[model samples]
Target: MTKSVDSTAPVLTSVRQRTGVIELNRPKALNSLNPEMIDIIAKAVKNWEDDDSIDQIVLYTTNPKAFCAGGDVRFARDNILSGDAQLVDDFFAAEYTLNGKLATYKKPLVSIIDGVVMGGGLGISLHGSHRVVTENAFASMPEMAIGYFTDVGVAHAAQRMVGTRGQASPALAKYWAITGYRMYAADMLWSGLATHAVQDAETILDAIVENGADTALKQHSYVPDGEAPLA
Candidate 1:
């Protein structure tokens, strides 16, 4: 059975048996992370963490263009432009805390990286135990483009991806660390950022349910054996 909750009037939470699905419903905002939404997500995760019933969690978005674009830049711009340093500090602190929680989460967590999985979106998805990317998926760090360094543990995650002080030319690392160039699904998988590349989002979701919550995830669970008609 699937259950849902509408918190902060915009974000929607859905749970099916031991699987919880959190949907970023603000398609107009490109499902950008905002203060309220962040709080809601953190609280929901905490609740599920203690609930023995939930063994898996899936974070996704309603917008096909973006799983999540990133933090609400307009919000940041307004606060910074208005000379509100406290707002900036608070936002970063809260967002980073939420990211950390997800990183070390106990239960199996699956992130569906279907669209614009950039900056903030990367934080939400990259740390999950199972990260699924679809053909529509694109990922990047691109914080330098906006005159900011990567945050939300990008430094650590990047090093993990590139290895510690390897001579293999840090160009790939630099692209994500500095330029924030969005990577396609294939590149994301090759770079070891996304675990699996699925052909269709719905099929992957169905597979998760059918596989049972306690089943160990297969690395290539997303890849279909052969091509099929488009849904």
Candidate 2:
């Protein structure tokens, strides 16, 4: 049954068979995470987590340029400057809590990233059990560019990821934290940040629902054609 489970105002969401799909829909803001979006996603995930009929959760976006650029920092800045400290506090609290929930989701969580993803977008995708990226996928953690540090538990993945160099080093994670170096799908897959890279990621969501992830991804997964500079 196709049912809208989350906010259609911006964050479009629906249930397709046993899969609960969350689509980042705020293209005007590059799908930046706002309190409302956070609330909707968190609530929907919680609902699906307890729903026995739901077999998995899927996150994707339709924007051609970006999956999610990051959190709505402009909103945070404006609210903080307006002395609405409570609102600012609530936003981060909800967002961070939602991050934790996504990281620990009970069911198979799949993130299909086909475009630019950074900051909060990384939060949404990197924590998932299966991160499928397309050739167009690009990513970074730009918090450092703004005089802030990375959050949403990205440091956990960064420090732990074993690149093709066959070594896991904290220095590598620190380099990304400080430089915000741009990375493509090849770099992501080679670094173990993204689990699978495919020329066509279009089949992932539906295929996983019908054929299961192992069989579905096996059919489409391939080496990214781009150069892995980080490798």
Candidate 3:
């Protein structure tokens, strides 16, 4: 049984057996990665890494509409325009560091990405051991649209995708980075961006509970058949 933590918390963290669960809690903001959220998550991840009770992590969002829309770009823009550019710098430092930590995490890291996983969202989930996408998921690196270069380790991730899926040329990867084109679940799978695509969130979690993370993912993954339906 899952234990409920403080519901009011901006980012809720809990543990079940060897699995540590992190749920992004700011649905109204589309669970945007802000400075505070970044700090809290980074701290929690470090603590969990050291905790004997936790052996793995599952990062997900509470909102069904969005795992994370992006970074707190509005906040970043406002602060920069107000001449408080330090805030932007701090945000980047914290976010990129957290992204690195997630990428290199010693234990298994599972990201349950359902919807609107874009920009900084991809940074958080894409680097982990498992990236589980749902039918509703929509992904992109939309930083260019906001006049910002793709960041938060996106450059490296995009490069890896290009190498893994040789069908897509290097120039195509660059175009996606610079153009902010949205990608559906099939496209993401085809491009080697996500690990698995499932029909729903509950099904994946139930599989995880029964079969453990990696086995469950392999069993449910739609990639083997090479058929990721658009509908």
Which candidate ranks first by lDDT, i.e. highest? 2
Give Cα-based local distance difference scores for all models.
Answer: 0.75, 0.84, 0.81
What TM-score should be assigned to candidate 2?
0.93
Clashes of each: 1, 0, 0
Better of 2 and 3 by TM-score: 2
TM-score of 1: 0.86
Tell me the alpha-carbon RMSD of every candidate. Answer: 5.0, 1.8, 2.8
For model 1, how does the per-residue alpha-carbon lDDT over 1-231 read when each residue is reduced to its tens digit?
655544444567878766888888888888889898898889889999989888788887777788988888899999989999799789989999999999999988888777787778888888888788888888788789889888878667765663212223345666677666667765666566777777767667666766753253462354434332211
**In model 3, where is the ten-residue run with the lowest total lDDT?**
222-231
Q: Tell me how many residue pairs clash in candidate 1.
A: 1
TM-scores, in order shown? 0.86, 0.93, 0.90
* Model 3 TM-score, all chains together: 0.90
Residue 221 displacement in candidate 2 (angstroms): 0.9
Per-residue lDDT over 28-129 for candidate 2, one digit per residue giving the tens place of the 0 to 100 score: 998999998898789889989989988888898868678889889999999989999899889889888888888888988888888889999988888888
In the range 68-130, model 3's lDDT, one tens digit per residue, is 888998899899999999879989888988999998998888889988988889888988888
